[model samples]
Target: INYYVITTFVFQSAIKLALFHTFWWMFSQNSHILFHEMMRKIKYARIAFGHVLFDDT
Candidate 1:
Protein backbone atom coordinates (compact mmCIF):
# COMPACT_ATOMS: atom_id res chain seq x y z
CA ILE A 1 0.00 0.00 0.00
CA ASN A 2 2.81 2.41 0.90
CA TYR A 3 4.60 1.49 -2.31
CA TYR A 4 1.58 2.35 -4.39
CA VAL A 5 1.18 5.67 -2.64
CA ILE A 6 4.82 6.53 -3.12
CA THR A 7 4.72 5.67 -6.77
CA THR A 8 1.71 7.81 -7.33
CA PHE A 9 3.36 10.69 -5.56
CA VAL A 10 6.47 10.36 -7.61
CA PHE A 11 4.51 10.31 -10.83
CA GLN A 12 2.62 13.42 -9.90
CA SER A 13 5.82 15.21 -8.96
CA ALA A 14 7.41 14.29 -12.25
CA ILE A 15 4.52 15.70 -14.20
CA LYS A 16 4.63 18.92 -12.22
CA LEU A 17 8.35 19.25 -12.71
CA ALA A 18 8.01 18.73 -16.44
CA LEU A 19 5.35 21.42 -16.68
CA PHE A 20 7.43 23.86 -14.67
CA HIS A 21 10.49 23.27 -16.79
CA THR A 22 8.55 23.83 -19.97
CA PHE A 23 7.15 27.11 -18.69
CA TRP A 24 10.57 28.25 -17.55
CA TRP A 25 12.11 27.45 -20.91
CA MET A 26 9.41 29.35 -22.75
CA PHE A 27 9.76 32.39 -20.48
CA SER A 28 13.50 32.41 -20.87
CA GLN A 29 13.26 32.26 -24.64
CA ASN A 30 10.87 35.22 -24.71
CA SER A 31 13.10 37.24 -22.37
CA HIS A 32 16.15 36.49 -24.49
CA ILE A 33 14.46 37.68 -27.64
CA LEU A 34 13.21 40.83 -25.91
CA PHE A 35 16.71 41.52 -24.57
CA HIS A 36 18.22 41.27 -28.03
CA GLU A 37 15.60 43.63 -29.43
CA MET A 38 16.26 46.14 -26.65
CA MET A 39 19.97 45.98 -27.35
CA ARG A 40 19.40 46.61 -31.03
CA LYS A 41 17.20 49.60 -30.28
CA ILE A 42 19.79 51.02 -27.90
CA LYS A 43 22.50 50.62 -30.49
CA TYR A 44 20.40 52.45 -33.05
CA ALA A 45 19.60 55.22 -30.58
CA ARG A 46 23.27 55.75 -29.85
CA ILE A 47 24.06 56.01 -33.53
CA ALA A 48 21.25 58.49 -34.03
CA PHE A 49 22.41 60.60 -31.13
CA GLY A 50 25.92 60.69 -32.51
CA HIS A 51 24.76 61.75 -35.93
CA VAL A 52 22.58 64.49 -34.50
CA LEU A 53 25.41 65.87 -32.38
CA PHE A 54 27.89 65.77 -35.22
CA ASP A 55 25.50 67.33 -37.62
CA ASP A 56 24.86 70.21 -35.25
CA THR A 57 28.59 70.94 -35.03
Candidate 2:
Protein backbone atom coordinates (compact mmCIF):
# COMPACT_ATOMS: atom_id res chain seq x y z
CA ILE A 1 0.00 0.00 0.00
CA ASN A 2 2.71 2.46 0.89
CA TYR A 3 4.66 1.55 -2.24
CA TYR A 4 1.67 2.16 -4.44
CA VAL A 5 1.01 5.53 -2.84
CA ILE A 6 4.64 6.53 -3.27
CA THR A 7 4.62 5.55 -6.91
CA THR A 8 1.43 7.41 -7.60
CA PHE A 9 2.71 10.54 -5.94
CA VAL A 10 5.96 10.38 -7.86
CA PHE A 11 4.13 9.93 -11.15
CA GLN A 12 1.87 12.90 -10.56
CA SER A 13 4.79 15.09 -9.53
CA ALA A 14 6.71 14.21 -12.68
CA ILE A 15 3.76 14.99 -14.89
CA LYS A 16 3.20 18.32 -13.20
CA LEU A 17 6.88 19.24 -13.50
CA ALA A 18 6.97 18.32 -17.18
CA LEU A 19 3.82 20.27 -17.94
CA PHE A 20 5.10 23.33 -16.12
CA HIS A 21 8.48 23.14 -17.85
CA THR A 22 6.92 22.87 -21.29
CA PHE A 23 4.54 25.75 -20.64
CA TRP A 24 7.39 27.91 -19.36
CA TRP A 25 9.50 27.09 -22.39
CA MET A 26 6.67 28.04 -24.73
CA PHE A 27 5.98 31.27 -22.87
CA SER A 28 9.66 32.20 -22.80
CA GLN A 29 10.03 31.53 -26.50
CA ASN A 30 6.80 32.97 -27.88
CA SER A 31 5.49 35.82 -25.75
CA HIS A 32 7.71 38.13 -23.82
CA ILE A 33 4.95 40.74 -23.67
CA LEU A 34 3.08 38.93 -20.91
CA PHE A 35 6.25 38.67 -18.83
CA HIS A 36 6.97 42.33 -19.31
CA GLU A 37 3.42 43.26 -18.36
CA MET A 38 3.63 41.21 -15.21
CA MET A 39 6.88 42.91 -14.28
CA ARG A 40 5.41 46.34 -14.92
CA LYS A 41 2.43 45.53 -12.75
CA ILE A 42 4.70 44.31 -9.98
CA LYS A 43 6.69 47.52 -10.18
CA TYR A 44 3.54 49.62 -10.01
CA ALA A 45 2.25 47.62 -7.11
CA ARG A 46 5.52 48.11 -5.23
CA ILE A 47 5.44 51.84 -5.84
CA ALA A 48 1.86 52.07 -4.72
CA PHE A 49 2.59 50.09 -1.59
CA GLY A 50 5.54 52.38 -0.82
CA HIS A 51 7.98 49.51 -1.07
CA VAL A 52 10.13 51.73 -3.27
CA LEU A 53 11.51 54.26 -0.82
CA PHE A 54 12.93 56.64 -3.39
CA ASP A 55 10.94 58.42 -6.06
CA ASP A 56 11.01 61.74 -7.91
CA THR A 57 7.67 62.69 -6.47
Candidate 3:
Protein backbone atom coordinates (compact mmCIF):
# COMPACT_ATOMS: atom_id res chain seq x y z
CA ILE A 1 0.00 0.00 0.00
CA ASN A 2 2.99 2.34 0.51
CA TYR A 3 4.18 3.83 -2.79
CA TYR A 4 7.57 4.69 -1.33
CA VAL A 5 8.22 1.12 -0.25
CA ILE A 6 7.16 -0.22 -3.65
CA THR A 7 9.32 2.29 -5.51
CA THR A 8 12.34 1.52 -3.39
CA PHE A 9 11.90 -2.23 -3.89
CA VAL A 10 11.56 -1.82 -7.64
CA PHE A 11 14.62 0.41 -7.81
CA GLN A 12 16.73 -2.08 -5.89
CA SER A 13 15.60 -4.96 -8.10
CA ALA A 14 16.41 -3.04 -11.25
CA ILE A 15 19.85 -2.13 -9.97
CA LYS A 16 20.60 -5.72 -9.06
CA LEU A 17 19.45 -6.96 -12.46
CA ALA A 18 21.57 -4.37 -14.26
CA LEU A 19 24.64 -5.28 -12.30
CA PHE A 20 24.16 -9.00 -12.97
CA HIS A 21 23.67 -8.37 -16.69
CA THR A 22 26.83 -6.28 -16.89
CA PHE A 23 28.86 -8.89 -15.04
CA TRP A 24 27.53 -11.66 -17.27
CA TRP A 25 28.39 -9.68 -20.40
CA MET A 26 31.92 -9.02 -19.21
CA PHE A 27 32.44 -12.63 -18.20
CA SER A 28 31.11 -13.95 -21.50
CA GLN A 29 33.53 -11.72 -23.34
CA ASN A 30 36.56 -13.13 -21.48
CA SER A 31 35.35 -16.63 -20.54
CA HIS A 32 37.75 -18.41 -22.83
CA ILE A 33 40.76 -16.47 -21.57
CA LEU A 34 39.70 -17.03 -17.99
CA PHE A 35 39.35 -20.78 -18.54
CA HIS A 36 42.65 -21.00 -20.34
CA GLU A 37 44.48 -19.12 -17.58
CA MET A 38 42.91 -21.33 -14.93
CA MET A 39 43.94 -24.49 -16.72
CA ARG A 40 47.47 -23.23 -17.19
CA LYS A 41 47.77 -22.55 -13.46
CA ILE A 42 46.48 -26.00 -12.62
CA LYS A 43 48.93 -27.61 -15.05
CA TYR A 44 51.87 -25.80 -13.51
CA ALA A 45 50.72 -26.68 -10.02
CA ARG A 46 50.50 -30.37 -10.89
CA ILE A 47 53.93 -30.33 -12.49
CA ALA A 48 55.51 -28.64 -9.49
CA PHE A 49 53.82 -30.99 -7.04
CA GLY A 50 54.40 -34.13 -9.14
CA HIS A 51 50.70 -34.93 -8.78
CA VAL A 52 47.33 -33.45 -7.98
CA LEU A 53 47.93 -31.93 -4.58
CA PHE A 54 44.48 -30.38 -4.33
CA ASP A 55 41.40 -32.51 -3.78
CA ASP A 56 37.65 -32.06 -3.80
CA THR A 57 37.28 -33.41 -0.29
Q: lDDT (CA) for every model shown?
A: 0.60, 0.57, 0.57
Model 3 lDDT tens row, 25-52:
5577687766665566556544634432
What is the C-alpha lDDT profile of model 2 across 1-57, one tens digit per residue?
575576557656655665566567557765675566556655655564453234334
- At residue 1, candidate 1 shows an lDDT of 57
Model 1 poorest 10 in a row by lDDT: 48-57
- Counting clashing residue pairs in each candidate, in order, gives 0, 0, 0
Return the top candidate by TM-score: 3
Q: What tens digits encode model 1's per-residue C-alpha lDDT throughout 1-57?
A: 575576557656655665565566557778776566556655765675465446633
Regions more than 4 Å wrong, model 3: 30-57
TM-score of 3: 0.50
Q: CA lDDT of 21 in candidate 2? A: 60
